[model samples]
Target: MRVVTGIGAVAATVAATACLTFAHPAVAQDVKPDRAIKYRQSVLRAMDYNMDILEAMVKGETPPNKEVAAQSALFVEQLSHMPWSGFGPGTDQGAPTKARPEIWKDPEKFKSLQNDLMAATAKLAASAKSGDVAQWKGDFSAVADACRNCHRSFRAR
Candidate 1:
């Protein structure tokens, strides 16, 4: 009986120690800029394709198609994560970041840009659904302009 009790106590102690080791507060400091850079580059790639899609539609060099518009929408949605992820603690301030600190400082302005991006992209997607070449071109240009405008102010040159 004493041997069985000793075995049970040992098992309990091992389990408790294991749980404590695993449960220690994980230090999840901010994610490094390199990790976010990949995401940003992907967003930019999507934007580049979207721009090509718009230009092609506008020139009537290619068919005005829903796929182009859908792609634009997808990229715009994807872009939401880049700015915040790439800007802060994990990023080396001296590194080549196109992001300006004003984005974090001026929350209202930053949020406005985000809102405009979403709205413009949505409009482009809607126009694409209808396969309207003219509307697609207009919305595409507008969205691109918005992107440029934000980059001008918020992104580091």
Candidate 2:
């Protein structure tokens, strides 16, 4: 009886795994638009929080900590590469998105802005790692500018 019960449990587990394997595509090619909005929104919010940390240090609103700034900058750099995937087709209308339709229409310009953000965030991370407060502060400013530029073009006010 024990062996029979164990085999039945194994079969159930295998069946569940097989169901999921058949139901979910390997690449997730057709994510729902609302889910895409949620995905990007979460990433953007985290990026903003980290930027706020760096901004506080730069503005003298909080004591500067090299380690904290370095970590925050690195997170910003990683996050820069993430939100673009959330802007794919059919994502403009779902959920409460600030994304402009121009993103879908003007892919080239949108891509350029994404690249600018990535570059600025990369520089900010490097400057923070170098432990130069002044240089990192400047780099942080550049990153902020990139963000604002993209928002102006592709995000609704």
Candidate 3:
């Protein structure tokens, strides 16, 4: 009788798991859009500060002042938290995202661009700590390139 009861419990658990797995997609769809939008908004704000840091770095005096280096480091740290939003089911797709519908259509291209940005940002942050003006300049340019590359493909006017 104990063996039979154990088997019955195991079967019930499996059945419950199967039901939840099948129901998850519909439940996920019920997720509020505002939650996604809020995440994107936070990323945008972080990117804004990052861009400002890059601008300051570019315009700052040669040899790079501590203030400038510190700003760049801050930018890199902020960017580390970015690119949180991309084209995905139920994600924002219009004006603010210009994330071309083609992003959904050609996922590989979008993902590549996103990866490129992440790599460049990671290198930029590392270079910022090097205190080598030349390295910083090169990494800075790479970061800008990544920004332009993604914007051209994903952002609409």
Against the reference, the lDDT scores of all candidates come to 0.67, 0.91, 0.66
Q: Tell me the tens digit of each residue's lDDT in model 3 across 29-122.
A: 4556555555666776677676666666577734457556656655765664454443346675433444456666777887887788778777
Q: Show how many residue pairs clash in every candidate, following the order shown.
A: 1, 0, 0
lDDT string for model 1 (34-110, tens) is 66555555667766676776677678888666776666655664564344444445444544566677876876887
Error of 2 at 46 (Å): 0.6
Candidate 2 error regions (>4 Å): 1-28
Model 3: runs farther than 4 Å from truth? 1-31, 61-63, 67-71, 74-81, 93-97
For model 1, the local distance difference test gives 0.67
TM-score of each: 0.64, 0.82, 0.67
- Determine which window of 10 residues in candidate 3 has minimal summed lDDT: 79-88
Ordering by TM-score: 2, 3, 1
After superposition, which runs of candidate 1 have C-alpha atoms over 4 Å from their true positions? 1-29, 70-85, 88-95
On residues 21-97, what C-alpha lDDT tens digit does candidate 2 reach at each position?
87644333488889989999999999999999999999899999999999999999999988888888888987998
